[model samples]
Target chain A: MISVLRRELLAFFTSAAGYVLMAVFPVAMGLLALFVFPAVLERGASWFHTKELTMRSFFLAFPWVAAAVMPAIAMRSWAEEYRGNTFQLLLTLPAPSWRLVAGKYLASVAVLCLMLLTTGVFPVMIAANGGWEGGPIFGGYLGCLLLGSGYLAIGMFASSLTSNQLGAYMAALLACGTLTALGSFAGLAGSSGALSSMVRFMAAGDHFNLLAAGYLKLETVTFFISMAAFFLMLTALGVEGRRYR
Target chain B: MLNVEAISRSYGRFLALNGLSFSIGKGAILGFVGPNGAGKTTAMSIITGLLAADSGAVHLGDDEVHATPSLVKSRIGFLPETPPLYTAMEVSEYLRFCGEARGMDRQQLGERLENVLANTGLSARRNMPISTLSRGYRQRAGLAQALLHDPDLLVLDEPTSGLDPAQILDMHELLRGLAAQGKIVIFSTHILSEVEAIASHILIINHGRCLAFGERSALLGADGKERGLTDLFISLVKKRNP
Candidate 1:
């Protein structure tokens, strides 16, 4: 597993894709947080004009940003192996299937962590502006990591389903986007019913919202972990299916 | 000894390997030859435990590869035609990954790494990225990774498919050297001359069934008959088609 992780990390860092993604992710998050989300939620007021020194704009815009960036980070995980003919080599290795899945998943998560870390400038800027409490900032970063893990897992599972990276990216984008979109519809389902509650629980945004609000519920943590584990297991099964075929 | 028994596999309506069976002992080079899509790669995959046989078993000595794939895979080395290589990695880095993936200890991996690099004539290029190497060197690096664990059975699917004459000769010599080291080497190719040059055992197949299997000498000329592999192969294809 460590071997797979090391090789994957080496491959990622050496390729232009890593640098491009690192550069693009923060720019995209910045545009969406300061420009796009504020335009949508505040009727043309930018985050700076909100009169608050909080990272609420950034936290709120993260799920949408993650829906794109996480899939980009993970789209090549298994698809490239298949295209390069290395999937057969991986299958023939003595390591268990789950280890390979975990290795690839962890490598993507490591990159995600770095991408998130780059966004630390958001909080630092907010701090240097006037100063705000650290609790929500910390919770928001934690929520971003957890939410990104779910997106990465979904992307990895999508990658295992196809050899074409573009197809994997599209599938993951659709899946992650749908799950994120669910959060926007929870209020329209009439606010106080089993259906609305079910939608809220199933959507990743609700849990992330709690963490971003400085409320660390155990169920919120469990939801993200379960989401990651579920998709990772599915990725392993996809790999194992090739052997039986 | 490597023993394959009644192995069969199918893909949708196409039966890829139909009750194929053959075996060879240590120090033997088994040349697997057949027409395109004759289940050569499929059979090799099954033998190495990379793919499952629908209704058969492959046993390397006492362990059934199908039942205990992880255990058996550690003792088998496989190189497919394209060579599953991470082109960004250096040759040594890739070999180290293969060794560690097979659960080799650091000390053992260190020793094997030196030997594999030397055996594959890749010692000088150990630090070079795989993407920068020529095709011949890439194939050598692939072989080096497969040999990193000192596996008992080495299964190569068309290892010399696209090599130049000089590279082909080098590959033949390498296979001979591995066979001399008491390892079982099974390689697939369409070149009959290559089989003639190195193999001690031969298995010929077409349309997912074995056409012939035996010692190269006995199969080439027996029952007071003598023929080259080409003549035998042509006659066999003719007999099957006509």
Candidate 2:
């Protein structure tokens, strides 16, 4: 497992894709947070609350950002291995499929952590702004990672389904996009009715917001963990399936 | 020592391997010669415990590989036809990863790293990305990865498939040296001269069946038969399928 992680890290960093992703993700976020979001929000009276310099805007925006970035991080995980014919070598190793998947998953999470680190400036700017309390800031960071993990898991699973990186990326984007879109529709379903409640319960945004609120509910944590585990298991099965055929 | 008994596998309606069986002691090279789709790769995959046979048993000395694959896999090094080289990784880094994947401790890896690199003549190119290496070097790097953990059995599928004559000769010498160290080496190849050069024993297979299995002398048939390998293979395969 450690070997897989080390190799994954080495592979990611050495390639042009990893650098481009690491560089592009933050820069795009900076442009949005620093310029576009602030500008657009200020122009719309209905978006007044969104224009406020609070952590909610940043937290709210991340799921959308991660919808793109996480897939980029994970698209090549298994897809490239299959295309290169290295999957046979990997499967033949003494370690089981789960461990390999776990290692690769963790490696992506490590990069996500690094990408998160680059966003530290946002929290610091929030801190420097004085009016906002610290509670939602911590929660927002937690939500971002938890939400990113779910995206990573889905992307990893998607990668395992095909040998084409573009196909994997599209699959992940579709899955994550649906999850993101569902959250907004649930929000529109309006806060009180059972129909609204059920959609809210299923949507990732509700859990992400719960974490971002700083309450740290048991169910919220369980949802993210379950999402990660479910897809990781699927990824393992996808890998193991190769030997049978 | 290795024993492959009654291994069979099917792919939908196609039977990839049909009750194929062979065995070899240590310090021997088993050359599997066959036509395309003859199940040579399937047999090697089963022997290495990478793919389970629908019905069969594999023994590495005393332990049954089917029942305890992890142990058996640790003892075996398999290089598939494409070599499984990660183009993004440098030779040394990739070799280290293979060593670790085989469960080699840090100290064990350190001790063997230098030798494995040198054995495959990849020491100088250790720092270069595998993509930058020539096809010959890439193949050597693949061989280097397999040799890292120092497994008892080395299974290679078409190890010399794409090599030029010089590269092929280099591979023959490498296989001979590993066999000299008493590693059970089994390689599948289409080239009869490769089998003629390195393998002391040969198994000629076709349509997922073993047409013949014996030492080089025995494969040449009884006293004074002295047929060339091409002639021998043609006659045996023709006689069996016809």
TM-score of each: 0.96, 0.93
Clashing residue pairs for model 2: none
What is model 1's interface RMSD? 1.0
Considering every candidate listed, which one attains the maximal DockQ? 1
Query: Can you write out model 1's per-residue Cα lDDT over B1-242, one digit (the tens) per residue?
Result: 99999999999989999999887999999999988888999899899888888998999999999788889999999999889898888889888888888889999999999998988889999999999999888988888888889999999988897678987988899899899999999999989999999999999998899999999999999656878999888888778768
Return the lDDT, model 2, position A227: 93
lDDT of 1: 0.90
Q: How many steric overlaps does candidate 2 have?
A: 0
lDDT (Cα, tens digit) per residue for candidate 1, span A184-240: 888888788899888888889878988999998899999999999999999999999
What DockQ values do the models have?
0.84, 0.80
After TM-score superposition, what is the CA distance of residue B190 in candidate 2 from its true location, in Å?
A: 1.6
The local lDDT score (0 to 100) that residue B102 gets in candidate 1 is 81
Candidate 2, chain B, TM-score (2 decimals) = 0.96
